[model samples]
Target: MLGLWIAVIALVGPFAAKLADVQHDKVTDYLPASADSTQVAKIEEKLPGGETTEMVLVYHRDGGLSAVDWETAAGQVAEITRQHELIGGAPKGIPSKDGTTLMYPVASNEPGANEEQRDKLVNDVREVAQGEGGLSVDVGGTGALATDSGAVYDSLGGPLLYTTVAVVAVLLILIYRSPVLWLVPLVVAGIADYMSMGVAYGLNQAFGTTVSGQSSGVMTILVFGAGTDYALLLVSRYREELRRIERPYEAMVAALRGCGPAVLASSGTVAAGLLCLLAADLNSSRGMGPLGTIGVLCALIAMLTLLPAILVLVGRRVFWPLVPAFGSTPKQRRSLFSAMGSSAGRRPLTVLASGAVLLGALALGSLNLPGPLKQEDSFVNKPEAVVAMETLAKAYPGRGSQPIDVITPQGRADETLAAVLGTPGVDSAEKGRTGDGWTEISVFAKSAPQSAGETATIKSLRDELKGSYVGGDSAQQIDLEVTNARDTKIVVPLVLVSVMLILIGLLRSLVAPLLLVVAVVAVWGASLGIGGLVFEPLVGLKGTDPGLGLLSFVFLVALGVDYGIFLMHRMREESLAGAEPATAALTALRTTGGVIASAGLVLAATFAVLTNMGLVQLVQLGFVIAVGVLLDTFLVRTYLVTSASVALGRKVWWPGVLSREPGPAEPAGSSGPAEPPRQPESLRAP
Candidate 1:
């Protein structure tokens, strides 16, 4: 198995390096294909100019602009025009009413729709449009914003990977308390990540899957986070099995047999939940589904095959100072989980009620979450484009600084321009780039971009334009908000039902699946509630990512159920072995709780790395998932689920064979004596 994996790695390693080359972060790549913004983008690409790159140069001063400042702005604009082949002739400066700011709109067809060309054009323009003294100059517009956002996304590759690996390694060292044991799984996870990348690249080639920076970054996160999780479960079980079995190879087999089903089921749930994203209208969301599945499956394969082969070859010495000698029993001492299970078993109702109420209260914080994030506020740090937009918002109050694109048939171009000019909130309208049976009309709103008034104006245009397509940076944001809402409605229910069905099939019990589903759903709500409380007041974020609700809900519900499966699967195994319901519940918690906690910490820590990312959406996603995983691990799984199981006894598995009383004859497949096995000393409550 090890030899085969090494050969496979050799075959696929080169493709992994090529994955980033195929990734795109264009605005249209993320938009819904059916949206007007998306249609406008596609149609413009077919027009004569082939989708022009647009930018705005802002020159501002706290004091009124002097004659020198005016000449400096004109000279800079002229220099930019001289340096680059702009679509229109030289740009004309539009001075602010306050006489403190001058703005120039620059458009160029040379770059067309090529991102690299556009980035180069924007950078070249920036070099000439430098600010000196009290005069502040910034390059801001859709093209510049895309470039800034793309740079941040591009940087996410190396830093994000290294940080995640470092975080997981530290957590593993702490969990194992061994010098060498942590390295094996981490290396295996890295290998799995490499394999996943190659497969992702292949998927893109074979199916034309849209690979965006956001989706690719998420794929890497899943490869490390979920991959490490499977490794922890397998390693813990192998350590336990080594104490009973004489040989390392046999012990590894025993561990795989014992824990493999639960791992498979958990990973399956996550894959299914992610696959539900395919139903979404947004291109990014749909693309994420397949790439994420590839990550999980690759992780699953490596942990199951390569990890076991390596451990078997290394033998018991791989465990170092804490090696599990043959036929040796671990020291018997009461653990934290034993005490927790005891408390839950003693007062299950009170514990369950308290947890539910706490979750309910936290969920109310979602109501306090800020509105949809604006493009200017999307970055964690203010780039030149965002700064320029901020300056424009202040200096050009009550007028739009960004152009609103309206694509219409050539025959209707005149009528559309007239209607756009007559629109109540349109500050100005002009026809541009007539070709290929389409005419592009640039409309500037009477209000600031992405503001409530501008949003209203966009909706009004869509209503009046009929055959015309209205789109731009602000229009794309509107489309994103609307599409995310639509996806949430469609995808959330699908995830819930899909995950629940998987749980039911795995557990073979209606009640148990329902309980696990409810717990995870509650975790999702509480985590988002926490984000609502912290995002604006603490993080200084102005608004939430529109996709946060849908994405977080899917991740929490899917990944959060993983710990529950570990605990409940053990519980079911114990019950099937003829242990009484209460004993089985407590024993399951006592035996599996520590490993589950360790896995949870590793997963949460890996995702928490995203909180430090530069994008607001990534920060929000990482925070919510990390918090939700921790809650599910420490609170819901440890306290509430265990308490409920103890409270309900056998009925937690209602309608399943285990729910009934064992007959006088020995329980089928019982390895121990007919009577229940004696409780272990380590599991005893102090």
Candidate 2:
């Protein structure tokens, strides 16, 4: 399949030029207002303060931009604002608050316009500023900022790119210690990623699916880590076979025969686990199910097909100076692998018990985690929207903040507000009272909605709006700015649950499938709790984009479960070999432990890079997943499984067929002894 893919690409490269336009960007990617965010609809809705397209604000003073200069700047701003027809057209004027700095508001006439609008807007600005005296302007806003974020990869991302690639490559080379063997997986994985992402884009186009910008980073981690993992499984088996088999093609066959089932099973479970992400209600969260699964599947297919074919084609040279360490004669059972098996065959209890307690304890945190799903919550630091919103809040009639639209047919806006203000738990309402004819009263409270007092006030307001006004609270818009955010929380959880059930069926597991879900939830909760504890008192813990919560949980559980499945299945395999359950678990841990650790670290670092990105949601997600992968890979995989295996011992299987009988007959021509080892240290399994 991989060969066919490479061949197809080669064959189609030239023809595609004549076929139809091949886009570098996905159709979904080009959607107006960013289809990836759930907030789009809400943001697009008409509310107070008016929605404005993002515009860059550039002003200089003094020794920079001056007041007289700013007056000219303001004049220039007004002129541009008048001439332009953009969402946030040229600033009406540069307001000089300090008399030294200029404040110009740039508007895009077309808020959701395409590249054409951006180009015209840019050119328009340049024309207007042909030669303004002592006036300097640098465009900066959503359009500019998003461009800058992407450009981060284009510029400083160079070192980051090299670092990521080189780290993975270097690690692979070190582990495999065979340059020729090392390079094979990298190339195949790269090709797989390209095909998968491209196909995913195509699928999204056909289905109207949307993906977050961070999807790219996740894809990168999946391709590198999962790709290398698959390749490691295949090549390691191939090497093991070479020692026993003389012929190159024959060795390849033997390798596949010996290890193919495990690889398939391993990759299958990982893919199945990730497929659970379809349960995510958030577009940003659930979209990864297919995106990541496809890449992993493609890599698996490559490992199965391209790797073997290439090895056969390359003959003996695949190992280079390593030569064929494997020979014609059947080789001795590996002391390490065999010893591991034997020890696991002995005492499995200790191993399983220790590991289980640790993971379960960590899993506790997930239960209390808040379900955050909206795109707006991720803003930790103050942003233009926030600052402007705060400024407006301070300036509005009810302190110039968000207005609650009370739908009561009976009362005036001012009277209703006054009534609500007088109600219990109400700190203060900035509005005087409900005004004549207006049932909805804009009320400003002393506290932010995030504060308990505010929430309590909102509840009181709702009650008043329901009882005090002619209409009920549901029908009327309360001046409360938080209703939609609360509504989002309600919706996102149902989505996550749906996605999880779908995943459970795909993974074919009951005992531990939920563990991944639990793990993800725990990590998410812990991160938020910790983040809140640290940030809440400092600047008031800003809730992250609710999408980040779902996104983190989805990815952590989906990807985190993948690691779990790999270890669990391997532990099961060892147990079946007659090692006591505890020992088998340890054996599984030891063999898979290094790979899990390495994979997690690489992925965690990749995600951490997003924290440096300075986006609220991105940083929140980075923190959550970074904590999650660490906990999952190290604590759960290494610590928990070992303990569970030990504690369960022989009965871990219960009434299962395996527990009822002696282990199956050792395969013919096998070197494992009929007798199990007494000591636990000797047991190990992958």
Candidate 3:
């Protein structure tokens, strides 16, 4: 098995290394294909220069701009015009009303659709447009912002991987306490991550799947987080089995057979939830579905196959200091989980009510969440492009800083230009390029980019100009927000229904599935509510990412349910063994509680690493998922779910065989059979 894995890794390693090469962070890549902005972007790429690279140069002084500063700005603009193939003509300076800032709009077609060349153009312009001691000069526009954002995205690969690995390694060490034992799962998870990357890259190539920085980064997180979770569950079960079975190989097989159903069900739920993203209208959301599934499935395969192979090969000694001696029973003591279960059993209603109220309170914070994030505010730290945009916003408060692109058929170009110029909020309109039966018109609004007035203007243009498409950075942002809202309404329900069905199939009980779904949904709401409180006030984030709610819900529900599965599956096993409902509930909690807690810590910690990322969206996402997982682990799964089960007793599995009273033939404390009875068909591992 080891040799087979080694060969597979060698074959896929090159493809994995090349995954970064195909990733794209273009504005259109994230927009829905059916959106007007997306249509405009596609048509523009087929125009004279393929795609125009637009930028704005802002030269400003604290007090006021002098003649020299004006001259310097003009000279730099002239230099830029001479060095590159500009689209319109030499840019004319547009001074601020207060005379504190002078701006020149620059556009070039030389770089076209090549991101590398476009980045070089922006950098070259920045080098030439330097500011002196009293003057501040910055390049701000869609092109420059894309370059800066792409740089951040590109840098995420190595650092994000290293940081995730380091975080998971530390957690594993603490959880295992055995110095060498932690290395086995950690190594296997890393291998799983590499395998996932290869598979993701293949999906991109074979099916032309969209590979964005956000999707790829999320894929890496799932590979490590979900992979480690599977490892923790399997290892914990292996340790328990080792005490009973003599041969190391036989013990490993028994362990797999014992815990395999729960592990498979857990991963299956996550994959199904993620795949629901395919129904979303947004491109980025849709792309994340398959990539995320690839990560989870890869991790599942590695943990089940390669991990067991290695543990068996290394023999029982692999456990080292805390090795479980064959035929020896573990020490008996009152553990923390036992105490927790006892408390819940004593006052089930009180515990359940308190947890519900706490979650409800946390969910109220969602009302405080800020508005949708603007492009300039997406970064955690202010980049050059963001600084320029901020300066422009303050300097030119009466007009938009970004251009609004209007694409129309060449035959109707004159009519469309006239209609755009007559729009209510339009400041100016000019015809630029005409090719491939399409004509491009650049329109500027009287309000700031992504502002309410600008959005209204874009909508008005779309309403009036039936054949023309209005698009640009601001329009794209509008499209993205609308698409995200639409996706949320569609995808959320699909995720809920899909996940609920999976749970029902696994547990074979309607009530059990409903309970798990409700718990996870509560976790999602509370997590987002926490984000609303922290994002604007505590973290100083200006706005929330549009897709934050939907993505976080999917993750928290899918990932959070894993613990519930681990706990409830064990409860079902005990009940099947003829134990009373209450006894089975407490027993399951006692046996699986510690492992679930460890697994939760590892999953939450892996996501928390994203908080250190450069993007505000990533930070918000990381915070919400990490907090949600912790809440699920310590509160919902441990206390509320357990209490509810103890309170409900047999009805928790309503309509199932376990829900009924045991027959007279089956004694209360009698062992049902010498060997455990086979699991029901629905309960068997896939």
Candidate 4:
């Protein structure tokens, strides 16, 4: 197995480093597939020089722009046009009503659809449009915003990977408390991540799945988080087996025999849940499903196969100062979970009721979450584009600085242009390039872009102009909001149903799966609620990402149930081995609680690394999922589920065979000296 993994790593490892090179950060890559904005983007790419880069160079002063500012703006605009291949003629400057600002509309196809080239163009323009003294120069438009967003996405590659690895390494070192033990899982996880990247890139190439910075970044997180989780469960069990069995190979086989089913079930549930994302309308979300599933599956295969092989080869001494000596028993002590079990056992109903109420209260915070995030507010730090947009919002007031693209049939170009001009809120309309049976027309709204009035105008144009598609950054945002609503209605139930079915199959009971599903759903709501409380008030974020709720719900429900599976599976093992239901619950908690807690912390911390990313969406998704995992790990799995099982006793198993027949219980009047309480049969090495 070691030789096999070494060969696999050698062959596939290089692909991981290449994932970032193919990752696309285009706006259309994330948009809904059938939305007007998507169509517009597709058509734009087919045009003469491909998509045009449209931006505004704004020159301003506190009091009023001097004559020199106008000349500077004109000269810079002329220089930009001379250097680049602009679709339209050299742009003319428009003076603000207050006479304090001069804006020049610039359009160029030099950069075309290449995001890097487009950003370079924007940066070059900014360099030439620089302002000093009393003058202020800012570049604002859809092209500039795209450039800024690309920069943020580009930053995700190295920093996110490094941070996640560092975080996982630290957590593993702390959990294992051994220099050698920490390196094994971390290295294995890295290999799994590399394998996942190769598969993801292949998926993207063959299936044309959208490979965005967000999706790929998420894929890496899942690999590390889920991979380490499986490692934790296996290593913990392996440690226990080493004490019983003399040979490392036999011990590993036994360890896999014990924890393998639960790990498989857990990773399977997560993968199945994520695969439900394929039903989503949004391209990015849909693509994430496959990529995330790949990560989990790869991680699962590695941890189950390569991890065990390597650990077996390393032998028990790899545990260093705390080696599990052969034939030795684990030290007995009062554990934290033992205390928690006592409280839970004393008053299960009270504990369950209080937890439910607390969750309910936390769920209320969802009401306070900000509205859909605007393009200008999508970053944690204001990018140049966001800053430019903000400057335009203040200086231009009622005027929109960005153009609304209307793609019309070439035969109806003039008629479409007339209709666009006739739209209620249109400030201006002009003919653009024509190609492939279609013509592009630029429409400017009287209101600021993405404002209520501009949105109304877009709606009006779409309604009035038959065979025309209205799209721009503002229109894209509107489409994103609408499409996300539609996708939520379709995807949410599918996710719930899929996860429930997986749980039912794994647990082989109706009630337990339902209980887990309900618990995770509550965690999702509470996590979002927590985000609502902190995002705006504490983090100073203006709005939530449009897809945050849906993505978070899917992740929380799927990944959150992982620890539940670990706990319940152990309990089921105990119940099947003749332990009474209450005893099984308590024993499972005592044996598995610490491992589950450590796994949860590692998973949560890996996700929390996303919070440090530049994009607000990544941060929001990370925060909510991290919070949900922690909540599920510490409160729901440790306390609530255990309490409920104890409270319900045999009924926790329900229609399963273990629940139907009476478990092995102490007989009355059996007063002989008790043998050392028999260990659960499942825990013994086969």
Candidate 5:
């Protein structure tokens, strides 16, 4: 099924992209009025003090800033100001202050300009800036960011295909140690990727869903990451089976049957978590939720259907080098899983306490970390914008302002704001336009955005201005940031509650759910603390994109919890066999610990590559998520898995609904107390 699905998808995937590409907006319509908006309207609106509005322009010159270069920079500023379409110019700079090579501000020609116009206008400015010189100049920021981003998105498809093929080839080389062994997983994963792409593209085309550059690359990465993971688990057991059974097909079937359920549940849980992102208010964010869900879902479907069929067809060659051992089943007792389990079980409290303290300390930094979604640093110091900014800043203290436009629909002009121009909090206020008798006033902030201080004040100022001027029939609108953050944080407990409830039903335990989320929460705090540590030293484009921190919190809290589920499920199985609490705890660690660790390592590393992306948001996002996953898998999960088991003891499988029936007596390991019980079908030797 995986192979066939791939075949069908590969045949049609391009057609799907082509159809969806038709909706691509070269020209944007009115302001976005609905959640379903998929065009240039996705471009953020610029308010007087609203978020993501200002552009950072970098200046370049030969051999740094000389007297002549400063003069040239001033000339460049004059050149930019000549374009009268936009209401203003990016202010000039003072290179003497703080090594700010060049800086200033520029905005759209029309206030109501949609995303398409803004993007084209900015790109045109960049082109115009570039045309003036011999210097190598590049323009960035949200305006240029999206334009550059689109090209990057188109490039990902080809690279992703290459990456998928490369990953399979590499995995086969390392694990099988022979090029011949590469063909099986390569073909299987390739098919899965192909099939998954078709579904993703089909959905996008049908729904006008937009897949950005980061998401595009991520889809490929996940397919490779997960496909390789599933293959590894299956192949390890398959090799074990081949040594015991002469019938290769039967051996393969047994391995598949054993690993099948775990794979399904793991994939399902990941997909479910990702789907929750759809609740985000941003269309760009909401659009991604479904793509991630579909990719994981496809991987799950492929593992269940197509992989089995392929294994059946391939026969003995799947384990060609190793001859089949006859008569006896491969040894199963005293496995590596039992070793780790027993060790952790012995020191459960120590391990659990240590992990809790470590994560708690990391959580403290997150509380104080500042900044919101302002893209100042994202501006790639292009020579024209930078020089232009430098000239203005040098000449005027606050000319290059990040303005907040407050529109009041009423009989009065925005004279209240006009009256507050000399007020303390404000650097300056200028009366803007009047539409439908509604007056617009612009407020210029004196301070650079820092954490929530300026953000909160700006919000307050906007509110006061609105209250002072708004009439009975006139309404006030503020466009700062509509984050799902606060609401999401509040509902997180609810989401965890919902997840806990599901676990209770699955594992038939109430206490088990709390332990899992607690372990998950521990990892979440640690991730945030670590993110602050990483950012404390980074003095680049990372600071400009505020969504980076938010993404870290989201990814770490959600995806990092997955291994907990996998670990706990195995623990419950081991405990029901009438093993003592310590014994059962050790058993789960021995088996699930090693595999979960490897999975986490791969997952963390995979996300780490996101840091290499050209985009700042993706880079920050990639690093933080990658670290969180590693911490969860290695630091938190390793300790908590055994600790929770020992702590819960008999109630690990509470309600006794999933209790095991009696089986043949088995001996305990002398190395340590074994979680004594005959193997259940789920973890049994064939």
Candidate 6:
């Protein structure tokens, strides 16, 4: 098995890094599939130039434009026209009424639909349109913004993966305390990550799955986070089994038998939950569904197969300084969880109530959260394009720097132009390139771009020119927000239903599954609330991502239930072996709590690595998931759920065989509550 895995790794390793090259990060790649903007983008590709890259070169002075500034601008414009294809004959400068700002609209098909080429063109324009002293020049438009956004996504591939690995490595070293033991899982996780990337690339080739930077980055995270989680559980169990079993192979088999179902069920639940994103109308969210599932499944496969084979080959000595010797009992020490369990056992109701209050308080922070983040404000660090937009917004008030593109039938060009000019809030309308059956009309709004007035103008244009399609950065943003809202209404319910059903199937008890679901939902709210409180004050994020609530909810609920499965599965095991309810719950905690905590720390840290990324959206997603996992790990799973179980006793498993069976009698030798019974050797089934 080890030899076979080694061969497989050799074959697939080379293709893994290639996944970064094929990633698509264009704005249109993330737009809603059925949105009018998406249709316009598609049709624009088939036009005369494949797809025009539009930009506006803004030249400004604090007081006013001098003759020298005007001369410089005109010379640069001439050079630009000489070097690049301009839509019209000579570039016409539209001077602001204040005479302080002049913007020249530049269009070219040279960049086509390639983001890299588009960025090159934007950069080239910036190189030529330079200013010194009082005059300032900036290149700002949909094309420039797309280039900047693409740069952020491009950074995600190498830096994001390396940072995640480094973070996970540090956490694992601290948790394991053994250099050799930590390397095994980390290596296996790396392999898993590579395999996921290769598979994701294949999916893109086969099914045309959209591979955005967000989706791909998320895939890498799950591989490390979820794969490490599986590793921790398996390794902990394997060590325990090694002390009891003689042969390493047999010990591994016993370990897999003990915790394999829990790991499988946990990964299954996460994959299923992510797959629910397929129902989303937003292209990015929908594409993330399958890519995320692929990541989880790949991690599961690597951990279950390659990890076990490698560990078995290395034998017990691989543990090195902390090696477990056969026939020897592990040193017993009082665990923090033992104390936590005892406290919960003593006051289940009080503990539960206190936890509820804390979560509720945290949830209130959501009220303080800012509004939805605008495209211009989406980056953690300001890009040149954003700076340009800001400069233009301040300099040219009540005027649009970017034109709203209207694609109409060529035969109705005159009527469409008239209707566009007559649209409320439109500052100017002009005929653009024509190809096939479509004629492009450029409409400039009187209001500042991305402002409410501009938004209203866009809506009015769409309403009046029903036959023509209105699309630009502003229109696409409108579509994104609307689609995300609609998607939330549809996908949230589907995710909830799917997750609840999975929990029920795994636990075989509706109440327990429902309990886990509710707890996770509360955790999601509380985590987001914490983000609301800190995002602006601590991180300086202007606003939250529109899809933040729904995405965080799905991730928190699905991944949070993972630890629940680990704990509840153990609780069920004890109960089936004739252990009383409270004793069973406490004993499960004492045995599994440490591993769950370790898994949680690893998962949390891996996601927190995303907080170091450049995009505000990624940072927010990472923070919420990290906080949510921590809450579920240390508080919800360890305290509240356990307390609820202790309080409910055997009734926790109502309608199950364990609940209906006769309770075990008290121990003959003990006066206090009897210790939870372990499964009899003869009764243990693999």
Per-residue lDDT of model 3, residues 1-686, tens digit only: 99999998999999999998999988777998799999999998889867888999999998999999988888989988888887777988999989999998998877355688889999999989999979999998988998999999998888899999999999988888888989999899899989988999999999998999989899989989999999988888788778878998988888898889989999999999999999988888999999999999999999999999999999888888889998897788888888999998889999999999999999999999999998988999889999999999999986888999999999999999999999899999999889999999999999998899999999999999998898999899899888898999999999999888888888878888899999999999899899999999998999999989999999999999999998899888888876778887888888888888888898999999899999999999999999999999989988999999999998999877777777666632234634444432111110
List lDDT for all candidates, in order: 0.90, 0.51, 0.89, 0.86, 0.55, 0.86
In model 4, the worst 10-residue window by lDDT is: 666-675
RMSD, model 4, all Cα superposed?
3.1
* Candidate 3 to truth, TM: 0.97
Question: What is the total number of backbone clashes in candidate 3?
Answer: 0
Candidate 5 overall lDDT versus native: 0.55
- Residues 323-408 of candidate 5 have per-residue lDDT tens digits of 34556554457765465556667777787777678788998866644444343333333233334434434433533334544455
Error of model 3, residue 336, in angstroms: 1.6
Model 1: pairs clashing at backbone N, Cα or C within 3 Å: none
TM-score of candidate 4 versus the correct structure, residues matched by position: 0.96
lDDT of 6 by residue, 25-48 (tens): 866678999998887887787888
Q: Write the per-residue lDDT of candidate 4 for residues 299-415, one digit (tens) a residue.
A: 999999999988988898889989999979877888888889888888899999999999999999999999889988899999777777887788889898899999999999988
Task: Please give the lDDT score at residue 281 for candidate 4.
Answer: 92
Worst 10 residues of 5 by lDDT: 471-480
lDDT of 1 by residue, 170-279 (tens): 99899888899999999999999999999999999999898998888888899889999888889888888888889899988888987888999999999999999999
Q: Give the range where candidate 3 is weakest over 10 consecutive residues by summed lDDT.
A: 677-686
Q: Which of the predicted structures, 3 or 5, would earn the higher TM-score when compared with the native? A: 3
- Clash totals for all candidate models: 0, 81, 0, 0, 35, 0
